[model samples]
Target: MMSGFCRTPFKYQIMKKITLILVTLFVFGCKPTEKAVETKLNYQSQVAVKGDWQVTDVSYANSDYIKVSLFDLGNTKCFVNSTWHFISNNNKGSMKINDYSCAYESDITWYINQNNEMVIKFLNGTKSKKVTTGYVVQYVPINENKFQLIEQADVLNKTQDIVLTFERI
Candidate 1:
């Protein structure tokens, strides 16, 4: 009878340990997992501007200012009639300048951000990520076949809009 009594307490102790472990596992297993939320890129404007486009015109709200260089490539006149090709699927494109003695071409990566800004990076044989400098312009769509890239420029200490009109080809 004494030996049985000792064994019963030992069994109870083992049972208590097993129950504690099971309860711990149950509590931890039922916990909700945390997941990282990723921001989805807006593709509406991307789809609307996808295709071949030509710079039909470049105009400034205040035209009394001096010659302005655009994107450090050349004068604003150089970009007029330039060709731009946008590939929405890969967010890559190219700009070709065949006017105003500014004969130049470059591979570019572009994307429309959540703020409706067109961000462009000119890659001159360098990786897209390696190029730190970029240009941001407000993207304004006039219609399916036409759009405007408005860049704010400081002219005589005043902010002015330099609009570049594009037409689909």
Candidate 2:
């Protein structure tokens, strides 16, 4: 009778098992989670908004309110082409009107209010002649390239909330 015992083979087998288990654990742990991705998306939206953006669409929160196009408001050209440049660090920004006749730029201050609302203030009389300052828009992080914002205004002495869709430029 003869018997053979090899320490190397046994050790190798045990090491292989440990490695396989560790790899399985790591793979599972590294898998992307939906919640984590959503959180990251929210953060990216916040930073991406700190740059230039243009209004693409506009609508009122309530369907009862009338919808008006840039031209419908007596604008010769598209007023939705307006641009807003939000400074990166400083709480400052600028709004540019590009509707031909209303073409003008204004120095503005912006902040993410306590309610996470985007509040814009037209400073130094930069606001449009017919507009007023303190326009607060609720910030809705839709994605990296686009976001939705809503703000209430006294359009006709009645407070109405308007939703604006913006696209990064």
Find the candidate with the highest lDDT and give its number: 1
Per-model C-alpha lDDT, please? 0.88, 0.65
What does candidate 1's lDDT look like per residue over 32-122, in tens digits? 9963222344599899999999999999864546777788898888898899999999999999998858889999999887777888899
Model 1, 130: alpha-carbon shift in Å? 0.7
Candidate 2: segments with Cα more than 4 A from true spot: 1-46, 61-78, 125-133, 155-158
lDDT of 2 by residue, 118-141 (tens): 766677565444445355567887
Each model's TM-score? 0.73, 0.55
Q: Which pairs of residues collide in candidate 2?
A: none
What is the lDDT for 28 in model 1?
Answer: 100
Best by TM-score: 1
